[model samples]
Target chain A: MSFTVEKTIKTCRGKLLKLSHNSAALNCKMVLNVYIPKQFYENASVAKNKIPSIFYLSGLTCTPENCTEKGFIQIQADKYGFAVIYPDTSPRNVTFPKDCKIDPNDWALGEGAGFYLDSDTLENFQMGTYISEELPQSLASSTDLFEDKIDFLKKRSIMGHSMGGMGALNFYLNSFERNSNGYVSCSAFSPVVNPTAVSWGQNAFKLYFKDYEHEGKKLDPTLILKNKDFSDKNLNILISSGDADPFLENQLKPQNLIDVVTKKNIKGIRVNIEPGYDHSYFFVSTFIPEHCEFHAKKLGLINHLIK
Target chain B: MSFTVEKTIKTCRGKLLKLSHNSAALNCKMVLNVYIPKQFYENASVAKNKIPSIFYLSGLTCTPENCTEKGFIQIQADKYGFAVIYPDTSPRNVTFPKDCKIDPNDWALGEGAGFYLDSDTLENFQMGTYISEELPQSLASSTDLFEDKIDFLKKRSIMGHSMGGMGALNFYLNSFERNSNGYVSCSAFSPVVNPTAVSWGQNAFKLYFKDYEHEGKKLDPTLILKNKDFSDKNLNILISSGDADPFLENQLKPQNLIDVVTKKNIKGIRVNIEPGYDHSYFFVSTFIPEHCEFHAKKLGLINHLIK
Candidate 1:
């Protein structure tokens, strides 16, 4: 659980800690950025209320820098007094020969395309366990993160963009099975909700698992949601997508996730299709306030805009 | 005033228009990104209260995308009902050879460093006339900008970071000499206050002007503040610099501006030295809300935080 602090930048009301640590799950070194809000800094030593955390998973072709530099979540995080953890999309410093019919230059097959899912075949591709389990455990043991002030284990939520959104939904649903205190809520921005129905998922899933047609269905958020009972959990979810997003039609099947929710008559899921927005950070930043508010309210934080 | 729309992106409560137009002033195809607040979009045709505009100048080696993508000014502009104009730092695609001692790889010389000063030596680098004069006129003539709804001619202010910050401070102080209803307020983030005293200013100034030492003083914000009278205009200015900014001590002498304001007994100029912050976009984005509110109040807009 040992970590190295690469850089600590002062931003908003607190600091953005750029950290790199070796993950036993993924084997290679992993890098992540954590934004600790001013509330934790002000009350780290003597506070009755523990600060909740929100893990923001990034999409493909992204380092932690993409969102850390552009996501604009620090403002809302500070306002709502929640810590934001920006984990790497996948493990780096990876050196392996091409496998699973993957081209040497396919961005969706390796490196950044871990899909936050543990490979049934490969030990190195366990991104699901990395993000959902190992990453949280690593953060909990890092005292420099003010573990006493910020809760990394139970009182936390998960959110992601594009491919990460699919991961967030699947992780949030499957998390409760592992522990009673799972994610408080989940949200996504232009997320890939149904991997089984999309090309990006079908292609990548085929590469990761030995039998993607059978193994990939288990990882699909839409498939998981239909069978997963969320009545006990209340299933707080907010999914926002841009109508003008180029990937909306084929790659991101937002409707698949929406259909399951509607058919199951689930409550607390607000799927907003915003007008004139695309899949860039412009779209993510536009609705970050909404997602932040959604997670903030579910986490029992006082958001000025909400109440 | 012929203009081409590069791209229009949806963000916050409005749209960010990426534009490129031939500048008659600089004799180059200048690119800029403008964020028109939702207020203008809502009331472009039939509105009595015209939406005021604010120009944002970016620093060295920056295109309009630097601030447009990562600056995070859209939220506050939407909140304050102000348009933000992000102009390119310097002229690009210059066919002129380096005359007065410039390395082929120097970032501060040819392309990105216009220094926002008209070259008494060259015609292609009239960035001072371009930003302060021609850009406003070009924007006004561009009917797609909805000139009727947005007031680009008057009630507009200027602010920037680094070299752009120097431009904003110098232009704000010198703007009234060109037009009566000049910039209502001026602000900077780690601005080059004493351009004559800094290496960045000295290097770039020598490259731009024939008489750098003598002519550079005329463009220095700190020097101009001493001689320039602002009693009638009630000059409103705000400056913020990070203590941890690498360039703060050498390139950006923020204290030089503060000292002149103190010695000259200038009111409405608030200089804040923030501890632990740096020169990155994190610093700019962190302090954007404050600068927005500062400009909003001076423009007679109701900022929720202030009132």
Candidate 2:
């Protein structure tokens, strides 16, 4: 499918480009924002060496704009000299049932919650493949992005908020072995840690995974982490949750992953539970810079500074 | 009328209080968020000394929350030792004709753009007096706010963005002489310089001032400056406009004030037309700290370092 760059501006010491493309992967037109670090613009050879990249996934009902506006990740990315990509959660033209009980505008289900999984039920919801495979490939093929700007050969890190966070974890776990570098690191905020235990996840999983007999086994990150076998790639895992987050005990139980990691003796997982933050972007913005810097260091783009 | 304190929390350095009150001046129920600096909290007597105060008026469709969320003003306020008061634009419950051809949901018209003028036409829109008179009087009378923490006798500074910028300028020029020790400083971003020329201001002013005799007289900061017989009072006016601001040229012509002040020999007006910045909060946040410090020194709260 062909895509066109809409607008590009130099900001935060990087080039931010908004692009639109007709996607067979998404089955509709979609838009995404890509931020190429000044390392690419200033020194073209760094990108051709395939410098490390990070993908930022946004939460439910949000568009590519939210992360750009409130996430405050660009500043950190600029400091770390890493490329950042933000993909919209879903395509346009998909209509939910009016009596679907879930209001279409509720932001949790219909639009912004792609959940980072391949949908076998909904005709249009093949976003998992689009993000993990096709979109990355497209980004790699485009000289404007990859030739001298991004080092496709380098390791990559993924992180997101709410649904996007769940998507990041699921994508990392599912595709951990495909890339030669393996999954470098992954993190999430207010993620649906145990999808089988929550209402939003339940409704979304039912819509996307319908008749898959491996239902409980497939979408749950904890279950996947336990059952999937792979060489320990030295993945640095960071998870932050707000104790005061209204959904922490219910939808976003960080304890689920903690329990599994403890049983499995996973070595490098770091979980920081904050005291009084909430589920809003205010909470996310406060910590997102740290996450970006964490991944940037793991991917070998920047040295971590002890502040 | 009686008012109730809704909530208060001790932030890292200071206290934040949300108060609800029946505003007889505005003729409606109103809410305000007041942040008292750490100095005032430590020494109660400082507030009664009439220490300098800076009032921040928010733009269209925003409440106290917008400034709190994105403004990044607290750190500067702490450094400068100033109290920050954010008052809502206007009360709800005013009705407009359906054919007014304005989208009621648009942030500019219905909810956020109070225009900071008493509405002679709408029964509910007498917010101008509330902001200019009653609100300040209430702050002065409330011993908890002004007794030892704020020195009303000291010079005052005012600043704002978009509609709020217009409000600050109007209020500063109109009422600065009577209530304030000096118009120490004033600044704005993308302010409606000529209300008679812009759609947002035209619609708001038409509804606010029903009598045509006051046409182009009330809430027109440039007009007030040109026609009113008032001394300059050595007000330190630092006005900035983003050249790339979408509203510039049409609504926020900083040149208007520059042209007037240049001809009138207004000694303290400093106009800065920034290049490439837009109308977003990023632009405001970048320069807001400087403006605060500018006022802090002028108000005698802090001694100016000899440059």
- Candidate 1: give the clashing pairs: none
lDDT tens digits, residue span B1-307, model 1: 7779998898887998889998888787888898988888775432667788999988888888998889899999988888889999888887775565667698877688888999887678899888877888878877766766778889898999989899998888887787744898999998888888978888877877888888898899988887778777678889999999999888888887778788878888899999999998999999998999899989888743344
Please, what are the lDDT tens digits per residue for candidate 1 over residues A54-150?
9998998888888888899998988898899999888777765455465658887778888998887656888988887888887887776576678
DockQ of each: 0.82, 0.18
Candidate 2 lDDT, A1-307, residue by residue in tens: 5459897654555667888888887778889988877667667436345567788888877888887766767667767777888899886777655544546666767667777777776667777778877777677778754564574334778888887888888877776545533357898877777777778788787767766446635778777767765436566778887777888888887888889887887777788888766787757766776787678778775653344
**Judged by DockQ, which candidate is best?**
1
DockQ for candidate 2: 0.18
> Compared to the true structure, candidate 2 yields what TM-score?
0.81
- Provide the TM-score of chain A alone for each candidate, in the order shown: 0.94, 0.90
Report the number of clashing residue pairs per model.
Answer: 0, 19
Question: Residue B270 in candidate 2 has what lDDT?
Answer: 75
List residue ranges in candidate 1 displaced over 4 A.
A44-46, A98-101, A303-307, B44-46, B98-100, B229-233, B303-307
